[model samples]
Target: MLGLSADNHHPLMLQRVTLGLVSLVAAFLTVTTFFRVELLHHLLWSNGPENNSSCPYGHFRLVGMKDCLSWLSCEMMQSEVTVMKLIGQGAVKQVFLAHWKGNKVALSRLAVSEFSNDFFHGLEMLKGLQSVYVVKLLGYCEDHTILTEYHRFGSLTNINSILEQEDHRSFNTWEVRFRLAIEYAMFLHFLHNSPLGPRVMCDSNDLGKTLSQYLLTADLHVVANDLDALPLVNRSAGLLVKCGARQLQGDFVSPEQLWPFGDDLPFSDDLMPPYDEKTDIWKIPDVTDFLLGQVEGSDVLRLHLFQLHRDCKRNLPQQRPSALRVVQTYKAVYTLLTQESELSGTYSGTSRDL
Candidate 1:
């Protein structure tokens, strides 16, 4: 959640101020939340900067580029390689549009080839865990390439632009967006509580390790991508041919359904939130609170992401919930928001992120 008086110049120490308010206001409210200031950080959890924990490649270390990436490879995802138009290239990963089995799809690429397996692992986990609010994954490549739907509406910015351009009346669009964000949190919750993944690769290792890892793991990809080539895309997100998708995802609060309950993973200590689904639930109202003229500050969303993030950054993995639980809670919040007379009158804006 963010509040900036439309000037983009927010007040100082706004994160704490805004978070305190969120605590008071949305204490029991359910809304779609945008917690992560960036999705790249959210995905690279332990692999992010600010922390120099041992990498999963045995004992290697990881670094952050200040910003996310937009290009990716095929092996990163769990699918075969094919050319696709570049879509987004945020420092975290690259987004691409491609064709598979005659179906048009979107894919995101990561900077490090090693993390591809983990990238698709998360997607696979999400796939088995169903949710209407969360995006669906058709397939992935181990080369850091992820395949999903190429949502055409663009981001919330694009939607907001359309709303103003169309001269539409004010509506509860913010509320709905907030609700959708929370729904994703609930989705994560179900995942956290769902049966343990037959096998979850928690590292960013190389090919030989990947092969060995596969033998040790189950529910693996049917085949591997032809790693002889790199992934290509058309409209990368930020710059330099980056080609990963950016759905305006912000990793602010942890999902309510997710709890910290796993190996006391050292790398996940900094900025890395445990699996608590509550983290997701905590942040949406913060974003929505600010969005609906609730808060004030520059990059209010970003600041709130950090503030709300404080509560979710616990180091325990077992305490986390799956994405499914976040989705369910968010749905409930969205339903309640629709009941509000003010937003109900103009609840026509779309609340989806593609």
Candidate 2:
């Protein structure tokens, strides 16, 4: 009692502890409220921002926002997506089968340690597209992984291989090949005629190098799965592909892309051929050839197919027909065959129709 104050030290110490705890709780609540407000503003901006500055190019704005978001920046909750297993590996990324919400999705993971302009721009461009043929981008993870709709049957390349081996009789059917051809042409047409104007949808390597890049959905529809390979023109200003082991070569490479520097000049990265729509156009013939070789029917159909191939491979890019024209031609021939088949028993075929 002598050393203690009038109120007693016990009560005073208890009061000090109570005050400190109260202050701690209040500070915690204040900080938590600020974060919650920011999160809500980001994820639930009901009314779109009035200013352009709120949403800029290459940035991922919310669903209701005035602008879209970059794949890496999308703040997807972990509960929304759960990684299942690794499905594939590519030059720069890994593909995993993941569960997004309740549905199965493909999670393409890119390394965050290295920054890629091409990877970011590709995803940004894909985010803007809403075509039936383009795979849907669900959202993104913090680790720079991209989530998209997964196709069950794999790529066109896989189908092509099976058909080539003639392992499955159903796959070798003329009807299937014809339908695939039409769908492929239509998808390319959609890309070439995009609002962005002839954005190089598919690069030289994957366009015709192998059919496997195209995915065959469970519904039998073909989707351009390698959208990251698609490039946007200068106006969008996002990312550019880094050229390392990717040297333009084989039938996929266009005449303009061929190096004429000769043996004397040193090999330079600057010599890489700049590809455009024509580069894709050049691969059309190869695609047609592969399809025709698989299964063909009727002399008339073969002739028509040959003509389409010839037009697609015209030496000059300008001389080559556009994707729309190619689609029209294929559809016209397809309709004729369908009508004939309806009238007759079935379409006739030759051993070497293509």
Candidate 3:
């Protein structure tokens, strides 16, 4: 009778154990679901201040202007901003990693007195062209000092090195890389159709130079960084612009950017024909190629972009597609590729089940 009781209790105990395990799993799943829902809600609704302007947090839209941060007086900047270390130096300014009110910021000071014109021009552009496509201008002081949001990853030039790190390896996928390419195209589109007028990326004379002109945000998106060389041209008024007085070479630059005059004739800025913003279009492929590094699906993306890029490289600037067109094409290709990948994954899973 005792042995029989023991066997009967064994089954009940086992059943209780199974029930306990199931209850624990259910509780864990419920908590996980709740947190995920909360996170989604926060991401959707808490992006910025409760205002109708739809601007990011700490930014407000001014009448007839893009979103902007509050202007920092020279006295306020000098008192509040603490310079940390020199991060970058260019012809016009020296950039420093700085701290402001417990936030990391980039502080730029005029480096060369001769380039004051360029520095002021960039500061004005930063103020006027404040948008989602460009880096956020936190504050500025007219004394040749400006402050902006600091991107820890630095410039797009450091993209490869960042991806190579173990902590960032998960971002090495083609989807992430393609998104970066899309952002770059969108930035170009924004510049070409800016509120100030059709602007050209005068600093982008080569691949390295082009990459250096943009910054890689901590979230892995690209934004226009160096606006010191942006110039406006009105096509309707028959106005054309040259990147610089100096002659440019290399296949990376558009054919029109090269010296059309023979070597016997000295390179003269007066003789060099000015080109439109399509010169920027010519460099799209090289920049996009660099953004879409050698990850899975990158080769396929390159193949898909080959024809469009070929059009971008056409000798005639007018023949190339507009920046908006390139942006649309990139987005479409990304959607198609992502859908195919998902379908492929589903099909493989179904095959395994069968």
Candidate 4:
């Protein structure tokens, strides 16, 4: 009887050991997977770009961006750049698709001599604002033409069409849209704190006009493309700037941006009240809303942004959040949404295993 009892207990002990080993392996795998996912999340969301140290232009460089070239002179641009076709035209300049040293580029020339001031202003802004947030300036011929990186995707207005294509369907996800919005906010933040002093996006009088000021890169990133009307505001000197001499009437413009005097008075630059950079802050929500697009998770994200958008549209410019604050909030919301999604996926996987 004693020998039989020992044999039975021995088999039971072996069974218990096997069950314990299996649980241990399962736990180990779960921990490993969780850590791997966390690492991936960090890598994807972190704004730091690799290979930035080698950038000779002393500006932040995006991953996969080519090395910066020396500013090309008029002779070099004229000799090397072969104009292909006119791709775009704005009030101030005409953009043509051109080939420069085997790489495609956009060559912009003053549309009319009357718009020379605007063209020169844009060129100066391009030279001064050579950062990751702004379009890459390749070369320029003062008062005549300017060359920059060519974005196949064109302006931000073409985003919907680009995403609708079958080959780019995968990029239509909310994650990608939210990333684009974040980049836009980052660009605004960079502009507001630029070395040239606090500058305002004066060209952004409406949604369409605002979208035209930015370009959509091949990699789905947004960069400031037009800076013709970017003006500086000196708050310390109590100086403010106007978007333009004309009256702007629309919900897109901030309440302060509109003509304060009723229809009883005609619009005049002398009578217009110049506004600070807060005008740009007011348009943030509008631009962000457009960038979010209509994707699977966009509605939920918009709901989350309701309060922030409301604050942005506040009647008082001072009440609105700063660009830096807006950028931080966007990043936080992005992180939260991504984590929730990952958690949901993990829970579903665990339920199936059970």
TM-scores for all candidates? Answer: 0.39, 0.67, 0.80, 0.82
- Tens-digit per-residue lDDT, 277-347, candidate 1: 23333443343343333312223333534443343444343343334433443343344444452354744
lDDT of 2 at 157: 62
Two-way lDDT contest, 2 vs 4, winner: 4
The lowest-lDDT stretch of 10 consecutive residues in candidate 3 is 345-354
Better of 1 and 3 by lDDT: 3
Task: Estimate the lDDT of model 3.
Answer: 0.80
Query: Which 10 consecutive residues of model 2 have the lowest summed lDDT?
Result: 43-52
Residues 149-234 of candidate 4: C-alpha lDDT, one tens digit per residue? 88888999998999899987777778777777877887888888887888999998889999999998776777889999989999
In candidate 3, stretches whose alpha carbon ends up further than 4 angstroms from where it belongs are 1-53, 56-69, 346-354
Weakest lDDT window of 10 consecutive positions for candidate 1: 213-222
Q: Which ranges of candidate 1 are over 4 A from the true structure?
A: 1-84, 90-92, 100-103, 142-144, 155-159, 165-175, 178-182, 195-277, 290-354
Q: What is the C-alpha RMSD of each candidate to the true structure, in Å?
A: 21.0, 27.1, 13.0, 7.6
Off by more than 4 A, model 4: 1-54, 58-67, 346-354
Clashing pairs in 3: none
User: Per TM-score, what order, best first?
Assistant: 4, 3, 2, 1
Backbone clash numbers for all candidates listed: 116, 10, 0, 0
Candidate-wise lDDT, in order:
0.36, 0.61, 0.80, 0.80
Model 2's lDDT to the true fold? 0.61
Q: Residue by residue across 1-354, what tens digits does model 3's lDDT show?
A: 436588798999999999999999999966855554334323322322122235654464432345455566789889999999999998889999999877788999999999999999998888778776777776788788988878889899999999899987866878778777877887789899898898999998779889998888765667788999988899789899998899898999999999987799999999999988999999999998998889877898899999999999999998999998897777667656655777688212211111
* Candidate 1 accuracy as TM-score: 0.39
**Model 2: per-residue Cα lDDT over 1-354, one tens digit each:** 458776798899999999999999999966855554334322211221122234443343332445455544345636567788988766556788987546677888774436465567657666665455566565665456677767766777666565555444544656557656677777788787786556664444644434755776543446677655665434355433222334455556556555547568756666654545666667776776566553547345667778777877787767888888887777666655654775797753321122
